[model samples]
Target: MTEQNVRRRGGGKRKRQRGRGEQAMVPDAEFTSYYGRPVVKASPWQADIPAYLFLGGLAGGSSLLAAGADLAGLPRQRRSARLVASGAIAGSLFALIHDLGRPARFHHMLRVAKVTSPMSVGTWILSAYGPFNALATGGELLGLMPDPVRRSRPGRMLGVAGRPGGIVAALIAPAVASYTAVLLTDTATPSWHAAKRELPFVFVGSAAAASGGMGLVAGPLDESGPARNMAVGGAVLELGASRIMQHSMGIAAEPLRQGTAGTLHTAATALTATGALGAVAVRRSRIASALSGLALTAGSACTRFAMFHAGQASAHDPRYTVVPQRERRDRESSPT
Candidate 1:
């Protein structure tokens, strides 16, 4: 055969093969079977995690606030601070125990401390702080250590011992506020993992604001001033951090901005703002302080719920996983 004829035949055969392949290929829409499914399972973390987080933050922050008030020579503030601190500590312990799959195994968490694990660090912090806070508050409540200067050496020693623990707890409070975010961000939850930076700040601010609000409601006006300021500052930081979290993240931010999360976030924002404003006006009227404090507490709770919902939403959605994985694949395949 001639070269031209041979070329023609080969081209025709190639075209025919291409057509057959096209006809054999099935469209993705035609197959409605469950072929491609998500690989990772959604975390079954219950409400207890966030509740424990909030209580832990509150306990840590309140302890610091109480210590600060004590140092300031505000007896009423100190008493209120100690009471709140003790309550928060107890509540946190309860929540932590409740959340554990094996509540009895919780003691094993303190067998040894690991700096690499937030949970381990948290366990140690609680172990050390919980008992000390309980003892200090108990002493004050029972009037066993009253007038330490005039009391026996043991009473004076107890007061001295309490100071160091209080100081230690105060130092650890910021970490308690922020580390919960780290714990969540380190997880597979898309919304939380994507918000690694802002989440810590948000939690910290929320903790501070919540604790301060509690103190303001419980303490006298003069002593509550610093707590009020802390609350205001925390609210401002939280609002800003939340805005940044929503803006910086793309689709991942949807959980926080829409549906149930949106409602909670909105309520949190409004309550926090109202509480901050009320804090300023609280100096004029005790009633305003009480009302604002309540608002802030409610706001803090809403914020925690919103954060938890956002994480769950992110985990439940397939787009969050698929989009990131697809982008990563595309980047890897691209030429340098």
Candidate 2:
């Protein structure tokens, strides 16, 4: 055939193939790991960890309130706060040791102080804070004894020392309330790590809510001013921080919005809001104060549990791991 005739023949063959719908096969890809396995292992943690977190925060925040009440000369409120601080710290220590499977494991952690390690620093914080809180509470209890015992030289010395001890504990309280957030965010878990910037705020705010709630429950209306203020401020901070974290985390926050985690978070928000409103609206009613305090404390517990479960959910799901990394890479490669 001639050259032009041959070219026409090739074009006709291509047209025929196109008409037959021949095309490349591009199988749709899914966000998954090899063999559909999880991208990361779920932490070997239980509900005890969340309990420990909540108790530790409660202890820390209560220590701060106790110091403030002492300085303000609100003896009744100071006593209540100191008692709560000591009890919560004890419970926190117990929960942590239970999670570690042995008491010795917790003590072993204090052998060395590592600046880069959140767990190590948290252990030291607890060690220092716990004793001071206990001493302060002891002094408060001593003062409650009959006049004869309270007037004893040893009792007077202890009471004198407790103010300084509690002041030292208050100094370390912020770290106690926030270090758990640092520890969680430092992990490879997608939801927890993505919330690095706001988690500490959420935690500290929850701590304040818990302690303030306790104060409202135990303190009289005349001395509940600080507690009311703390509860309201803490409620605002916790709710705002949670919203910011969810908005900023993108896909990583999905775990927090779905399943059991979502339900808990919703409950926490409602309870905290209601408690804050009740605190402001019914300051004269002891019944209202007790109810509000209970709500706030419950809300704080729910928040901790929600965060714990969300981190586990994100770690178990490959999509939460893969999608964010891919998006990050795309953003890096895109033109500015």
Candidate 3:
């Protein structure tokens, strides 16, 4: 055979070479095995997963904000932060339970602690955080747990135990916001895997901003100064991160710009921007605070749906998988 024929046959002369012969004989359609069984089924993850993720982040962020306010000598801010934090935590737990295919089986997740598994770590974090958050709120509600109890041996023990847990929750708050991104990244989902880095940052920022918005709405204006600042900062970060995500993802980011995902993303962006700006103007006004809070909550919810739909969109398109893999292989084979 001529040299041209050999090169056309994937640069091989052997007639019985399975690798080269397979590529040569099979059409692109046949080579792809697109007609075979699908690589992934529809995600078993329910809507509650997104809801719980958002709420858990809000709780954690609010707790941190409250702690900061308490340190700053803002009594009303501390109270509002504690109250909202507790509510968010409770709502998160409820959503988590509701999402489980077998709600009773959730205990199995805590049967063994595995650091390598995000789910396992998350379960432990929740287990440790839930009660402490509840107690903190309880203490605030019961008028600071009484001077005697605050200083007693049992009180000290409770304080010791609760303090560490609170700190852990605060530290984990950002992770809680971002880990859902990791979950989506590890999957076969196209949009998620493609924009892995940006997704996490966007979620984290949104959570923090949402939490700040809640604090602003619930607390007195003078006490809510920090929350307003935090909300503004978070909104700026989220907007920048999302823009980077869209630009970096190329065609895979199409879902984020179109269809249901597109609509939600646009709404989220608008609400987040509006609320952040409102925070500055309403730092002292209850009415402004209320509107900002509403916007932030709506924005956070829209973000979650946009993310979920983006993943679904990515998974539905075969080109997302095929084109990237082919390009990678081609690049690897080319000489420097």
Q: Give the number of the best model, judged by lDDT.
A: 2
Q: Arrange candidates, best TM-score first.
A: 2, 1, 3
When 1 and 2 are scored with lDDT, the better candidate is: 2
Q: Write the per-residue lDDT of candidate 2 for residues 1-336, one digit (tens) a residue.
A: 554564443422222264667433334455566676799888899999999999999988888998989899898998899888888988988989989998899989988999899999999988888888777887888887898888899888888888888899899999999999999999999999999999999999999998999899988789998888888889889999989989999999999888999999999999999998898899899999989998998999999999999999999998888889999999999999
Candidate 1, position 180, lDDT: 77
The regions of model 1 sitting more than 4 angstroms off are 1-38, 144-154, 328-336
Segments of candidate 3 deviating more than 4 angstroms: 1-39, 144-168
RMSD of 1: 7.3
Off by over 4 Å in 2: 1-24
lDDT of 2: 0.89
TM-score of 3: 0.82
What does the lDDT come to for candidate 3? 0.76
lDDT of 1: 0.77
Q: What is the TM-score of each candidate against the true structure?
A: 0.84, 0.92, 0.82
